[model samples]
Target: MPLSFFSGGGETGDLVRSYDWTSTSLGAAESWPQSLRTTVSTLLLSPVPIVLLWGEDGIMIYNDAYSVFAGGRHPRLLGSKVREGWPEVADFNDNVMRVGLAGGTLAYKDQELTLYRHGRPEQVWMNLDYSPVLDEEGEPAGVLCILAETTERVAAERRRAEAEAAVRESEGRFRALVNASSDVVYRMSPDWTEMRRLDGRGFLADTEEPSVLWIERYIFPEDRPRVRAAIDEAVGTRRAFELEHRVRRMDGSAGWTFSRAIPVLDGGGRVVEWFGAASDITERRNAEAALAELNATLEVRVAERTAELQRAEEALRQSQKLEAIGQLTGGVAHDFNNLLTVIKSSTDLLKRPDLAPERRERYVAAISDTVDRAARLTGQLLAFARRQALKPEVFAVCDSVRALFDMIGTLTGSRIRIMTRLPPAPCFVSADPSQFDTALVNMAVNARDAMDGEGELTISVGAVDQIPALRAHPAVPGAFVAVSIADTGSGIPRDRLEQIFEPFFTTKGVGQGTGLGLSQVIGFAKQSGGEVMVESEVGRGTTFTLYLPRVVDGVRPSDDSAHEPLMDGHGMCVLVVEDNPDVGTFAVQTLSDLGYRTVLAATAEEALTELATDAARFDVVFSDVVMPGMNGIDLAREIRRQHHDLPVLLASGYSHVLAQNGTCGFELLQKPYSVEQLSRLLRKVATWQRRARIMSQ
Candidate 1:
């Protein structure tokens, strides 16, 4: 039974002869059965790998090819049992042995198995064919296996199948991306001749047409050249291109689009294809354009609103000016009517043929007093108008207040208690002393009226370093002497405080007050480089503070000549220039009564004619300051030029020209003058002219 009996001269035959098989269940090779020997000889002689399992143990026998398949276990497995040789595939081999010993054949194509080869476990596939080897009597004997390892062929086929599946999945994802996109995705040939494919059909009106034709038709005519140029450039240079252009939509409406593409290049540095996408940007562009238009409209509207606001402010100012003028007219009419009543009554009373001397004297005195009061009233109006001429002098505020206390008490009546708080030292201020006294008296009377005739009126004088409340006042910032008149009386309302300084704005009932008192006080303070402030609350008393700029210089001496006896004109010729005929007659009569020979002229021009006719005829010219044509100041200037020796006196009730041009180097006397006052002014001018003439001679 030794394989030498059925000799074969191959590598497997030599390995079988050298291998020790006595320890195996098949026993020594020479003890092997003849049938097994013949099967081994036949397997050894085969070209493909073949193995034979003999007897009940299914002892292993293999050819050279089979030995190669056995890898590192070949020599040892040559005579071993099949299970012992390939333990990993033992159960499979057992089924093959069982079926083959039953005289049946078993075959498997690409059967999978795990085997120990080269001393390590390996996964392999094989095509196995099993057949039974018969004994001498033709009973079942052994299993003869013909096998081919198909590991490499099967692995290659599996790799090819996986590759195909991956390609399919990748293409599926790509198509999904294209179909789901909002932008139109496209590919074009390298020559830019045609579009290869396109996705996102919803963006196109004619999906069946080529992309180039679609673009030509749907794109705005104006944008065709640029889009064509961009595509050409991308193809020529093999570079990315981007552009934004207008497109005509399917609805025949225009919209905007942004298109971009990158050229695909081949290894030869030639353009292969271009991949591109176009996005709808119509809404964004429209919104931007609308915002620009809205900004322009907003600018125009803002300008219109600003102009309207300016116009409203100008109209308000004009309305306030007109109201002030009406108030001034009303107040002037009321006061003049009152003065006329007194004068008319007195004149009518004097007209009685048998009037008693005492009654006549009393009427004349009443007329004189009323005339003075009227002149004072006109002066107050001028002061409030800022037209009154000021004769400023440095005076002690404390001393002035002290001197006026008794007079203020009398003016307030016995019902009001007068209190004075004067600083220890004199606080000097530069102002017209008379106007200052008038301001004080006006404030006191206002307080008395507010108190309803029974309240304490406290007048306090002090020096202030800084008055924060007067920061906005027109007065220059500096030290000031504050004369505050506070009254324990009904306070002014908060809403009416700002209007209190306006002329004719009053709380007193009609006919009770002229409403010019506080206005005049405010004007006086402002004109004297000062200001007035008031603090009041309902149910609390009001305090009015007059802040006059402090004077650092010595007090000016008072004029003692004011108390001088009245001097007559002594029959000197006088020329009276007045605009009104009745006023001209009154002036002429008044001068004549003052013992002057008077001539009447209704205008400054008429007065100039009279003086030109006989320059030396009139020793003095007394002219009203305001007239139709040339004013009193102009007449005086002409007289001074022609008749240098003549004396000129200018008088006015209220003259804007006088206020603007000042006295013009001439003497000024307030209007509605008493006969005595006229006599005194005429005498003073005549005397001064006489002395000047004597000195010249």
Candidate 2:
């Protein structure tokens, strides 16, 4: 049989074909049993994010799409136990596996989960589906999982809900303010004796029926006498009655109001009735009394009043700045809408069964392109927000900057003068070099625009012992490398300086800038254990300095460019030891896919057990540096003490023992390694092991 089911989805499909299933619970790839093989093939070929859990342990096998979904735990999570893979959500997965293996199905929409994908707890929402993958015996064997992340959609919906609530609240407040302005209307007989029905509109008690003793009911007794005098004077003159006096308000409080009435005169020169309006003047009256009292000591209170006004002004400014949140969401929604439009249109067109094949391909291509754009947009957002998924390596900042000079020069227009200043020695820092390069390029492009394609832009690097405080954060004293970019152009305004780092906030004209560049810069800097500082003098120039903690020792980049071509494992046995269940699973699976025989051990003790079984059979020991009992360094030392010719390669994101005692002269690979990185490192280490054994002979 061709076994064509394992061929062609993408890199993931290729992995499935190359993987050695004999090392796993599923047995050998060629002998996996029809049902299991078919399920594995479906997992590899699916465009959607799907995974297959084989056997009781729920060993994981995910497609490329799911690799993206796995976040920082992708390659390493491939062959790990599902429960051990996501320890933060172990209970959740345990329930899933239990139900699934029982031949039951489970589904959850927008199920919230907190996972430590990048060494930090992140709240995520997912639409999950799980069903059993039956074996040839028609019994429950493994689980099939389909997942869709809805975190961004949830966030957008929340933002929209908040925005709508704000609008409704604003409308309600406006209506209330208009009502509270304190106005009313009423009609009175021309003689000013009886009053017609009155509408209080909140100023005083309403009069549903005409009343004769309106003054007694609606006005204060003492004020009524004065009101009567003013009314009589106006009525006798057949003119408007106007008087400001105290009244019985609706709440039964004696409050001041300004009341006015106008007499309606007949054409025959006789008055008919009076109509009037009133306003609550309680606050104004109280203010006038306070003003007179304060005037006696105005000089003494002037300074205090000024200070209060200043504080109020500052509060108003802060409130205004918070309104930028709407702009940020609006920008994201706008970009997502554009991407969705393309997908929507393409799918709609594709629904026509009789559509031409050529047009069908075109529409499909369009959809694929839109999805890619959407993925890039999502990555950009992640970079700006958390940047939790970081792959750090030790590299010299000065060397990296020098390598990017040509690219930076190209980004800033030819008319601009690009110059560089570097220290005598290489300034080393442990960080994600790709993100570092991206941040530098973004700053360079920003500089190019600031200069309007013509000005001097200087890039400099130096070692610093401390970082001066940036914004409100306290000054940090440590070994740091300062990479500063200075531009001689129109400087940023003091007012706009604080907002420049805000997502989607831009001073550039519309269609000019997305405003995500600086946000990414700040995100990368902060996530890399550093900070970015900006100093701009209006009309003079601007300087942006990024400070990252220096890598003190054991600073060396992986020699990925070794003089060896990519090679297959060719059945060389390897021992894999990792306490992080997820990473351990992925490591074993990845090496097996590379055609090596793998034996997985979750701890160093287990690894020793496997080594003791047949120490000489294993060509290399691949282990994680940070484990629970007996760290990778001690394990390596123990292995060296017994099996002196065995090669042990360790991996980690960070380890206290490794940092304190050093790599112990053993090779080390960083965490979040790619298939290629793992492959090359293993091949190199295995080659050393072979050479050592040959020398022993």
Candidate 3:
């Protein structure tokens, strides 16, 4: 069947031989009829990626599209058996070609095929078709094959089915999650009135679409403006919104809820839906507020209790201090009484007219000096007890110490070397000038005792901005003028330091110490908003530091100028009410000697009896402070009722308790007074009575 060259044609129209394309296309160049080429080419070049194969004993060559469908197979696979061309698909290809050669058509829609191209992964999905090629005599010749790639469409359909399944499973899980959550999950339109709350039953049916008035009705009135503004802003700006407000319950109780919303935007960026949650935090909020209020109340109570306890402790300390002073004074007065007896006997002997004048003068001077010494002792006791009134002034501490140096030199008994360490700048404190001097003298005496009159004593003064241990002591913090008295002697033991400030607790043996020294220092410091502390070692020495808060502008000095002068009582008759017979007898005798006629009563009843006898005879009534019945002030009022012109003087050992009641207009004198004080007080009362009588006349 080769083409023949004919002699009948001209040179331009030379005869050509017809070439066989059957071997390249259908695996047999002579077997493939020309009519089959057109049909196969048209189908392979269609819109969907398609391939064509024709075969005799193997696959024929296909179009470029067909080669791509095969994916990296050689284009020269013409006349090769389909099994030889792709051995992995050999059985499948053989079966497909056998059915087509047997004149049976085969079709496969959306079949997934996997192929390796150059050892790289390739996946293809195709609609496959195989048909038989017939000869002119109606006999089977070869197989025709067509492939259409459908990978993307098949994958999309599979993903859609999986997504639908996932949605169903997630719906159940999400419902459980929302139900278990403490917050109330919800969906709403942009208007916020149409809220679909998601409970165990999907969303609330009533709120599928609600009118704006529904939101207004549910919202708290006070929160309406803010909630409205937030909604408006969120809708206008297409942004998320949040708010916290109280919601009224069906039972009329209000509870707080915090709500938040996130807007779901459409493709045009307009809010289409809102997803939000609200939490019921009413109990938590209420509990927090209540706890805060309770904490504040507790804090205030604690502060008050602490202050009250401090006041009670201070009162106890004062009481203990007074008791110790009383005991010390009582014992010392007994000893001094004995000494006074001897001194009085010697002075009496000297008072004789036959005695030598010089010897008498010496004896008289010694008596005067001893009396002065006794006065000084009583003054010290009063100072330590804080019973004496102070005349406070802002004075330089340096001057006070310097003035006391000479006195300290004499007091230290010439055995201790006195040293002074004064600050370069003036350190000032507010206190009575005389009492301040007395305090320093008392400390110096104590130092003398600590050193046993043989060690070095140092008095130092300085101003400090802070004391390190003061706050720990529960003391005030401020500028302080520190006056330190240090003794180089056997130091106070650690355990006895706090006890030293307690009254009557002394380390010194009897007759060697009064123990009022450190107690006075402590009381003075406390009254001045300061404190006292001791630093000591076992064998070294002890330093007693007295801190006094410094005043910036200085306190005004007190005037003691109003004190009246002493007078002899020669013209007055006095009524004395004393509960104790010994004290009454002593007062009667003392007043009789002072030239005052005395009427004595052992009790308030006896005094009332005497007053009933002759009320006008008494110019003044002097009564004991404490009594079995009807105290001195009450007795004085009874006496005044009968004798309105009578002047009263109340004598007491318990001066502090009497003064606390604010009973004024009567002269008060502390007990254990001298003969001189009695005479002077009587004269003042007599003078007052005479003046009153003159005014009435």
Candidate 4:
């Protein structure tokens, strides 16, 4: 049965007294059926915080549940006013009554209500709903309420909102930082189909296009696949990524870009996206290219300079070799000349009235012929060795070429025809006349040999403002005197052209030629600031072109012959030391013939013994550089110990060894000398002695 139809004993206060059970025949009837009474009573009395009120009057019938909810309000308080029953919540009850009486359902979804129930004080959030009861006339009466507490759910919701706000704020800061950077910052999906990017320059802007569209349009076509792969790798491994690629700009130009990225991962360790920045590096790349090109150019220049240095070193080596040859030749000539002096003196002594006329004449003629041969040999040696120091004077090439015509006639032996083409005007060059003559003779001799003694040789001298391809001759461009020697002889082979200037490299057969001729000519020309060029073909002829730098001054005459006069030593006791018996006897004889009283010492010990035995005798000591026991220089020193003022002359076959000995206060004489040179050296020594005596005084 519904609670509205239930009646207990008799209708109490505010009850509808017209109801049949409450008013008809039993105002206070207890004769109701026990089940009905029990059912009605239970409906009105069971507990669950239910309260029945009769307007502002009181609780009409409060259940055990309502008494428990009220925390000590008794059921005996029924029919009492609600303020007397629960004074503490009088204001709450009045507000609820007003809402219910106005016919509105007052619902609280989550409302916190505080109450002191049985001294257990606490707050409970409840979902409360109130519904009003009606009288028989349909007037609003008491209200019924239903409530449920949800404090935990409300608190949980508030905590979740706070945490979300914090995460959003942190993400906003990160986005700001990416936008403020100079590089283009971006994020991408693992497949790279979707992109999120932050424009570094546009962080401050209020709005801009999405990063995804920007990358899709701007990524260079060629680099897109590679960039995607890089991003995918970073995502899969959750590692950092770095790559360089080209970006196609909006204007269709490509820019080199360097990108660096780090992968962002979720809690499951799966890649979510990639965060990266790409910087434009086109300028740096261009600079590196330019630097590479410059370095290559510098390398080429250094190689060229090194080649030039090597050439210069070769030239210096050649000069030193020639100098060495000269020294050797000069030594031999000195020794030979000394022997010649002895022979000549002996012949002169034999020519005296003591001999038969026919025999004397025969000796004279023989000596004369022998002297001529020796002189010729000396001259050839000097020329080949390049030892005869030139006395260079400014001379015209035209005059030199003209003067060499007669010499050419004699040297060529009429087998080769000589033609001269002289320059119309004078062309000056600094050179020795004899050297120029010798150079001409050599060229003519070579030509004659090339022609097999029967071809025409043309010698042409001309002034050139500039040489023909002279700059290509490994020399600089300048004015030159071109003396071209053209021969119609058997031509030189093309392969042999460069070798012509190399000493001892000759095409002529052994014993017929010494290959120093052209080499000497080249040396002389270079020393004179000129260069030599040769053009040859196998069957055709050869032309040796000499380009000597031009000079301004004309020919200046110089003394060609300043021969030393024969000097007889003035009874100066001299010491001669040598290890070779033939050389020793020859030197002693030569000195004896020169009127010097001589003493012979074959070694340093002998020289010292001779000096000790005859302390005040010798005025000069002459010795060869190398010997068996003691050398010449040491011998000279020992001789000087006894004769302090004595002049010492050191002779050597190899002149370079003499340079190392540091000859101070001593004179040096290369061997193989002429009688005249011996006489001159003796006179010089006598003069130096006389000067020394004066200085002592």
Query: Judged by lDDT against the true structure, how good is candidate 4?
Result: 0.67
lDDT of each: 0.82, 0.82, 0.71, 0.67
lDDT for 155 in candidate 4 is 72
- The Cα error of candidate 3 at residue 50, in Å, is 11
Evaluated at residue 118, the lDDT of candidate 4 is: 56
Q: Model 4: per-residue lDDT, tens digit, 563-632?
A: 6666777688888888888988998998889888898888878877887887578788888877877777
Off by over 4 Å in 3: 1-354, 361-403, 419-438, 451-456, 460-473, 477-482, 488-493, 514-516, 523-530, 537-541, 547-570, 580-597, 608-618, 633-646, 653-666, 679-697
How does each model score on TM-score? Answer: 0.57, 0.37, 0.46, 0.41
Ranked by TM-score, top first: 1, 3, 4, 2
Candidate 2 accuracy as lDDT = 0.82
How much lDDT does candidate 1 score?
0.82
Best of the two (1, 4) by TM-score: 1
Q: Which ranges in model 2 have alpha carbons more than 4 Å from their true place?
A: 1-383, 389-394, 504-514, 551-563, 573-594, 597-675, 684-697
Residue-wise C-alpha lDDT for candidate 2, range 570-678, written one tens digit per residue: 9999899988778878888888888999989999999999889899889899988778888888999999999988899888766656544558788888554556677
Whose lDDT is higher: candidate 2's or candidate 3's? Answer: 2
Residue range 1-697, candidate 1, lDDT tens digits: 4455757738878877777888777778787777877777777888999988888788887888888898998688877888887888889878988899899999899998888897778889999998899988899898888999999999899889999999899889888988888787777777766764467374545556465565676688888899889877776676788999998765778889888888877898777787888888889999989999999999999999999999999999889778656666666777888888999999999999999999999999988888777767877877888888776788888878888888999999999998888878889888988889999999999999899899798999998875545535543558998899999998989888888998678765555546899999999888787888999977778999998889775667876556777766678888888888888888887766667898889988888889778877788888988888898888889888988888999888777776666687898887666665676777789889899899999
Candidate 1, residue 430: how far the Cα is off, in Å: 3.5
lDDT of 4 at 326: 62
